[model samples]
Target: MSKGENTRKRIIAKSAELFNQKGYASSSLSDITELTGIKKGGIYRHFASKDEIAVEAYKYAGSIVSGKIHEALDRETTATGKLLVFLKVYENVVEAPPFIGGCPLLNLATESDDGDPVLRENARRGLDNTLELMKRIITEGVRSGEFKADLDVDALATFALSIMEGGIMLSKLDGDNRHVRSNIDSLTAYLKTVAAAS
Candidate 1:
């Protein structure tokens, strides 16, 4: 990468971290400059505005966590195993998150709900991608006879995502992994109920 490209990435990384922790509205350009050690002019040279930086930073943050989840999912051969892996990844993140703070999608969704339209849309896309992944897995499971034939894939996917995100939020707020672990346990039990006979 060129020097300019490298600098832009550094700025995005630092901004993502700050945005995850302090939120976009609270994190200032000065804070990003301080963290990145790049002057204001340098930052502006790469990003036209804070909004632009925030969109890129949010995408960067989402990719970090999403990449990990995809890796975990790929390791499982069965749809049931893939679902379990998905839940387990979130459980692990409660203890050792891929990014600082917590889940980027959850953070950005809540932070931008009443604020930045760009960020809100980005967050929504991130969430939609996750739901789609889960839906695909469930749909495959049903077709393969690995899961119940009559399962409501879309509804279940939405429920699972909500449970996972809620668990993360509670775990982060309480400063304990038990909350997420409990949710994961519940998810595991629920998955078993949906799984077909061996």
Candidate 2:
């Protein structure tokens, strides 16, 4: 990459943790400059505004975690296996999150809920897309007879997302992975109950 491109990337990479931890409105250009060691002039040269930087940084963090999820899912062939893999993907989030603070989706979504239209939209987009992916998996599981035909895919998908975010939030708050571990066990047990066959 060109020098300018590399600098821009460095700025985003460094500030992603800052934004995720401190939040967009709370994270000033000064904070970014301090964290990234790139002055206002250099930062402005790459990003038109703090809003732009926040969007890119949020996306950067989201991509890292989501990439891990997809990679793990790719290893599982069955729908039930994929579902288990998905839940297990965040098993280490409390101890070794993709970033320092925690889940980018939860952080940005909660922080941007009452502020930053652009950010709120991006957060919603990410969330909606994830729900759709999970819904698709559940739907396929039903069609393939792996999951019971009567399963409510939409409701289950939404519930699973809630469990994931709630578990992650609790895990982060307590600095313990037991909540996540419990959530995984509960979800796994529930899925086994819904399985079409043993």
Candidate 3:
């Protein structure tokens, strides 16, 4: 990569961490400059405004999360195993987050809902992508005779996502992992009930 490209990526990486922790409204250009050790002019040279930087940073952060999920999915062969891995990944993340704060989609969605349109949309897309992943897994399970054919893929996917995200939110708010653990247990039980007979 060129020097300019490297600098832009560095800025995005630093900004993503700051945005995840402090959020877009609270995080400032000064914070980015401090975190990246890049001058204000240099940052401006790459990003036209804070909004532009935030959009790219959000995408970068989401990609990190998506990459982890994909990695976990790749490790499993069966659809059921993939779903279990997905839950396990979230459980681990609750106990030890990969990022500084927590799930960027959750954090960004809650903080930017009514505040920043660009960020809100970015977060929405991240969430939609997650739902799509779950849907694919469930659909595969049904097709492979691992899950009941009558299952509602869309509803189940939405419920699973809601349970996971809700658990994360509660766990973060209370500074305890019990909420997430309990939710994971419940989800596991639900999954088993839906599984086809061996």
- Which of the predicted structures, 1 or 3, would earn the higher lDDT when compared with the native? 1
Candidate number with greatest TM-score: 1
Per-residue lDDT for 1-198 in model 1, tens only? Answer: 999999999999999999988989999999999999999999999999999999999999988988888898888888877876655776756558878878899999999996878888998899889889999999999999989988999998998888888888888888888888898889888989988888
The residue ranges of model 2 lying beyond 4 angstroms of the native Cα positions read: none
Superposed Cα deviation of residue 166, candidate 2 (Å) = 0.3
The alpha-carbon RMSD values of the candidates against the true structure, listed in the order shown, are 1.2, 1.3, 1.4
Local distance difference test, candidate 1? 0.88
Instruction: Please tell me which predicted candidate would have the highest lDDT against the true structure.
Output: 1
lDDT of each: 0.88, 0.86, 0.85
The CA lDDT at 1 in model 3 is: 100
Angstrom error of the Cα, residue 114, model 1: value is: 2.5
Q: Give the range of the ten consecutive residues with the poorest summed lDDT in model 3.
A: 86-95
Please provide, for model 2 over 14-86, each residue's C-alpha lDDT reduced to its tens digit, 9 standing for 90 to 100: 7889988887778899999998888999999999999899899989988888888899888988877777665
Query: Which sections of candidate 3 miss by over 4 Å?
Result: none
